[model samples]
Target: MPVTDIITDEKNLTLTVIADFAHPVSRVWRAYADPRQLERFWGPPTYPATFTEWDHRVGGRALYHMNGPAGEKSYARWDFVEIEPERSFTVDDLFTDEHGDPAPGMPVMRMRFAFEATDQGTRMTTTSDFASLEALQTVLEMGVVEGTRLAMGQIDAVLAGLREWFAGKGTRMEVLTDTLVRVTRAIAAPRSVIWRAQTDPVLIRQWMLGPDGWSMTICEVTTEVGRSSHFGWAPDPGVEGEPFGFDDQLLFLDEPFRIVTAGRMTGVEGPTVTNDLTLTEEDGVTLLTTVMEFPDAATRDMILGTGMVDGMEMSYARLENLLLTRPVV
Candidate 1:
């Protein structure tokens, strides 16, 4: 197991657990920040967990449940009290019922997870603060320590699994809901570098081309919210295809991590669509996920049938190749 120390302080009404991993701080933080990755090892092997709803920001709450071998389930919720990206986060953990309401007569524990760089890699320090000594004793007596130790031991596999899942996989698309779709790709670079390649006008022109016979005729991108950005593409000489473009305005921005945009085709008459993009790094590779929302199921099916994912695969492959030889831009 990666855990190096586990301490209990009755006087302070706290339990501190320290674990070490052979990965960067940012990668470990990403594992926790991403719900898909976090669900892998959040519970014991006999009781795997599944998160139904996850709101990752402060004041947000997450609802999850663990399924036992005998078809039994245990529910829990986390109220995000504070978040500091790669450094730390604090959450109030408590038991909850199916309807997302708190269970009566249960102890709520406030857990702070701190991550810092270490000589080997990263050190994770988790401190659980109890409201009273009785609370601390109650949890200890209920086997929290053993369950946590088993849970922490399983995260290494999750981290390793993530590394294997995305490598060499091209742009992947999935239908998330009746009116929503998600596209994902993993690039062999850091989040900051990927963000720059997607945003910088000069770099965008180099690899934003969707197909072999096309060129970026115009590239205008902005990080400022409410500002419109435009991108246009034209076929090379003797190449076949109509010139196309998209005009979009930033709806929300969280620099280098997430962005939301609303946009429509340049000259086509259609309903505008909303896109939410998120980036997270694991083991030096950045995973880019974009969720697109359409007005209705008809719009969703019509657009997807247009080979949108193929164009995205071509563009993303170009971006990956461009990054390999990129100078400090």
Candidate 2:
């Protein structure tokens, strides 16, 4: 039950995480070196993980598959550089293809993990080295620190449960089997007023463009379950952006009450994404919730890095403002 601290060396472009656990050396070591254990905590809370080619020996390698909320998948790799049983190990970690082919950039990571004997358990120090300060900044700016911490916290719970089971005690550990981001926003208007803004292109033009730096380029609807629709976005204020639009399959709907759509972000050709939008009414207020399921952790991380959340937040703000300005019809 020791503390954990994540540190950054701005000059050397290094990140360090120090943690302690009540588990023995063997248990803690397995948690990091075992593929099954590693897979249980590799990605964010939202997705299930799969690992392959995991050989935890010196010079051996491994690949992992991260399945995202939308059923899309991304891959990562690790080449073990050094391994000392129950003590420490070092590896190169990065995004890669299933065959261990490196991805688009030289975003290589040198990771060193050391375990020291402590009074009751073990102290683990994990450090990562990047190519440059810019690369380190890039990951941090992409919310890697927060995301990794959340994943590791899940690991901690698993380890704790193992300890409890070993001590002949009942361990009730909860692994987040699934997580959905349900966004809820209230518009102080009748359900029909909000529905009009959602359905009427004229009313959509008033607020859906999202002010500046965001514009909806395409909006298509089929109004059927197997049928599909598309909506595109552009950064330009007025002009439509190229390749901006979604190809969405209508999954379910309860009219102005609920909607479930599956679609991908419009691209020439790549992975597909699915999103669900739900609408509800409460005491003369309209609530809208959007839940997007990504294909994998890499895609999700990439989308987050690309500032999608900021745009969504701004769009929500504009909708709220527009609703306030327009009188109830």
Candidate 3:
């Protein structure tokens, strides 16, 4: 686990938490940018959070609720003030009502999250400036300090999951004939679990998303060869892009080892892409290698420019979280 250091300044009425992650700064940044990933570790383990609103851009707002063990809920909101991608962001946070409005007499906290690249990995420093010393003390009395420590402690597990999606230090990207791209990741879970998560609709929906607030509106899978699998994503409200998805035909299935699918992006102009997914086990971990062949180099380059790689990495990180926390059936 990473060391979490907390600092309190009574004179300035502020609190700061500094922690190190074994993953890169970009990977740590996604944990805050993606709402679904944020919700997984935002609150204490006993009080998990559900984010109803999330916008990572400046001037945006986020609304969420933390559900306690007895079913009680505490609502909160963050008003984004500044945002620098993969570096830092500032927000004004406050307790809110169930209707998404700020509650009266609640302490308003100005918070900043800074991500810095380091030799060990990424160092994440979070500082919270309270309205006054009294306000800071009030939160401290409510166990905010301990709860925050517990919540931040979960990042280690989150990073562990993300590391598996990154393909480790030797991840190499080669353009074979300019039409094929191969990406590999070594996952800690067994091959069977990874296969099930890829083929089962229920499990697929858990992790196959671009970011938070986006949802899979349709996920239907047929494992048998020659059958078709359909997946669709509905973007969050006010987002610019059209709902995008894929329609895939299962061409090959080798149980918990390999699967080959020929698919096309729905509502997009592109030739069919054949995806070859292979999984192998070493010791107790599984190595997943995926090869995607596009119809042409132009099409491949065009897709690459659309930030699809970042989205895929975020999705894979979510998948790692699911595999780590979900019960095996």
Q: Which candidate wins on lDDT?
A: 1
Clashes of each: 0, 11, 0
Question: Which regions of candidate 1 are displaced past 4 Å?
Answer: 1-161, 327-329
- Model 1 Cα lDDT, one tens digit per residue, 144-223: 88778766765874666545767777898867557767688988888999888878898888888887999888898988
Off by over 4 Å in 2: 1-3, 162-329
Greater-TM-score candidate between 1 and 2: 1
Predicted model with the maximum TM-score:
1
What do the candidate models score in CA lDDT, each in turn? 0.84, 0.67, 0.78
Please give the lDDT score at residue 255 for candidate 1.
Answer: 74
Q: Write one digit per residue (lDDT tens) for candidate 2, span 234-317.
A: 777455555366677776655674456676667657566555554445455554545556667666556656656555556666
After superposition of all CA atoms, the RMSD between model 2 and the true structure is 15.4
Query: What is candidate 2's local distance difference test score?
Result: 0.67
